[model samples]
Target: MTLEGKHALVTGGGTGIGLAIARDLAAKGAQVTITGRRQEVLDTVAAESAGLFGLAMDVRDEADVIDKVAAAVAERGPVQVCIANAGIAEGRAVHKMDLAFWRNMMATNLDGAFLTIRESLKSMRETDWGRVIAVASVAGLRGLPGAACYTASKHGMVGLIRALSEDYLGRPITFNALCPAYVDTEIVDRNTASISQRAGVSADEAREIMVSANRHRRLIRPEEVAAAAAWLVSPGSESVNGQAIEIAGGMM
Candidate 1:
């Protein structure tokens, strides 16, 4: 589907699934604005996509999010497509999790999404159409061991999307969440190391453990999730509102 002239914004768009989605949107003729904490990573991705603009902003910072999104809209027009994909994935058992760890996850995954969507909606409401997509995880759908904080954060994001969908029922906008399991990204690499150290297992074993987390017994490609994001923005998906489309290889 063509998104010609549409302006799309993706948070954490520097790498992994966010970068993949940003590239897909850019290829489909949308002027994409990608935001991340690091300018270097954003620059690298922006270099590869002609219409993609990179902005250095941290989603976890409320003021920064407000300023950057406003700037993006001023430069590229309204954000018809907003993807709340900035997040932190960390696993810590509930009892052992400190307040700082829990707060960080909640701030990045939940608060960041709220700020991003809220700010974008201001400009989007003035337009005729809009799409808000949140990149949740399988953890959002169910509890995973040693990931209480992470799961809670994702679950909160899905909750926010669902509530917004209902609040704007008749509006020309859609809110949805994409839930994927064990995607092959930097988060997985970090988790592998953590698991290996925590469980006293070899790194290979830790990797296998994550691969087995998915029902398909394999790690998902970032492109797979990106394809799902693309579909959500396609014309055929106009009726697919308030849904959490899981990409966990039949795990759902």
Candidate 2:
């Protein structure tokens, strides 16, 4: 159960689910590189864990992903586990959405995941084994109300992972996605405020709206997703490809 010599990269690893996964990989003896747009946040978190290195990189920018990831490989080794986890989530009705809003959602969620996976694969494919995991949303499997743009972007992310899985079916590399609902992260905390402002409700009331979406009627912890990620990259997960594993406490 040791990834003693593996090199891993997690995009948007400064906080939330990405950070949890990065820490877990580091704990398992992988030289993990955590990337995000915020340097301070990355530095702060990386210091708390062994084998975790923070590099400030934006997933939405192609040049940044290519150069930074290449540098990470040179400093450590080829990336054997690539987690395309950087993304943004927001809710807005279709009729009221502007072009910037729509494009912003797609650019960060779908385009960012694509760029991260493609760049990481440059080094990952050089190795005999690899894992590519996309942190998609439960919304990807079903239409989310008042979030058409977000739903579309996640669907694209899931589609990309599925297609890549089929293309690399016989290879040692595997592609999969984790679709979680109502994670108890900063994103949900912020969304509560946004929902309150938009819908004229109390922040607590708005938060409950998201919490109730989960079948368990509670927000999920970040470590739960990290556990799944650790399993996917472990030695025996070669057959677990092209799956969008839902973590919503029940079937969707």
Candidate 3:
């Protein structure tokens, strides 16, 4: 499906799944704005594409999110396609998790998605069409050991999107979430190291543990998730609102 002239915004678009989505959208003729906390990373990604615009903004900060989105709207027009993909994934047992760890996960995963969607909606509501997609985790749909805070944050994100989809039932805009398991990203690499250190196992063993987490017994590539995001923005997905499209190798 062609996205000609559509203005799309992706949070944490400097790398991983978000960057893959930005590239796919740009390839489909959309004017894409990629936001991240690091200017260097944004610059690197922007240099790779013609229509991809990069803006340095921290999604966890309300003021930063609002200001950057406003700037993007001013320059590229209203964000008709919004992707809230900024988040942190950390696993700590419930009893061992302190307030700081819990709050950090909530702030980045849940609150960040909320603020990004809210700010983009201001400009989106003025338009005739729009789409809001949140990048949640499989943990959102089920209990994940040693990830109580992270799982709760993702669950909250899906809940928020489902509610908003219902609130705008008849509107042209759609709200949905993409839940993927064991994605092949930097987060997975970090988690592997963490698990190896915690369990006193080889890094390869830790990685295998994550791969086994998926029902298909493999790690998902970032492009796979991007494809799902692209399909959600296509015309055929109009009737697919309020859904969490799980890309966990049939784990859902």
Candidate 4:
């Protein structure tokens, strides 16, 4: 069915895959609320799209998530779709990794998803239909050689989604995670620079290193991930709960 008049909330929607998903949902006739830490970026993007609104909220803060999500529900009606997409991607060798680095990774990638999902569920439970899509990573399915912390965080996110799906097995709501590999987003740009400096390789070489991670030898597009998300929240997806759909070009 179309998303006409439904309310969809996407975290980290200022840019990247989250923004792409927000745009797609809005185009499908959903009233979308996109959240990020930057009001300006969120506002600018929302301003350009009809039926898309912006809010500034950090998922890492439980109180903030609770309040902001409540406010969104109060204004937009019950949230029929919730996407937890805010995350940080950084790699560090086990030996050189500090406790601060590990904690930060877990807080943003795992804890943030948890808080966002938990808060959203309150409103979702009051409704008859709902969808929760967590933006996980392919690293969760296996491992990334130097990204132990990030991999663990993503694994946690996938686990959380899977468990939630089971918890609501007989309900009208569904919980699923999208695992994508090396998408061509701003995160990749930042990762390219980080990899170049860490590996002492040229920028182009570092970029290729990531592209090679995907079996297709290319960067996956943000729209591809957005499309998967759109389908998950659309009609004919009622039985697709708890699955982590991999967009990794056969990397699975």
- Candidates' lDDT values, in order? 0.93, 0.93, 0.93, 0.93
Clashing pairs in 4: none
How does candidate 2 fare on TM-score?
Answer: 0.98
Give the alpha carbon lDDT tens digit for every residue of 1-252 in model 2.
Answer: 888999999998999999999999998999999999999999999889779899999887889888999999999999899999999989998999999999888888999999988988888888899999999999999999999999999999999999999999898999999999989999998899999999999999999999888999999999999999999998788899999999999987
Name the runs in model 2 displaced over 4 angstroms.
Answer: none
Candidate 3 worst ten-residue window by lDDT: 243-252
Candidate 3 Cα deviation (angstroms), residue 141: 0.6
lDDT by residue for model 1 (97-181), tens: 8899988899999999999999999999999999999999988889988888999899999999999999999988999999999
Candidate 4 ranges with C-alpha deviation above 4 Å: none
Q: Give a tens-digit lDDT track for model 3, residues 186-240.
A: 9999999999988899999999999998999999999999999999999888999
Evaluate model 2: give its lDDT: 0.93
Preferred candidate (lDDT higher): 1 or 2: 1
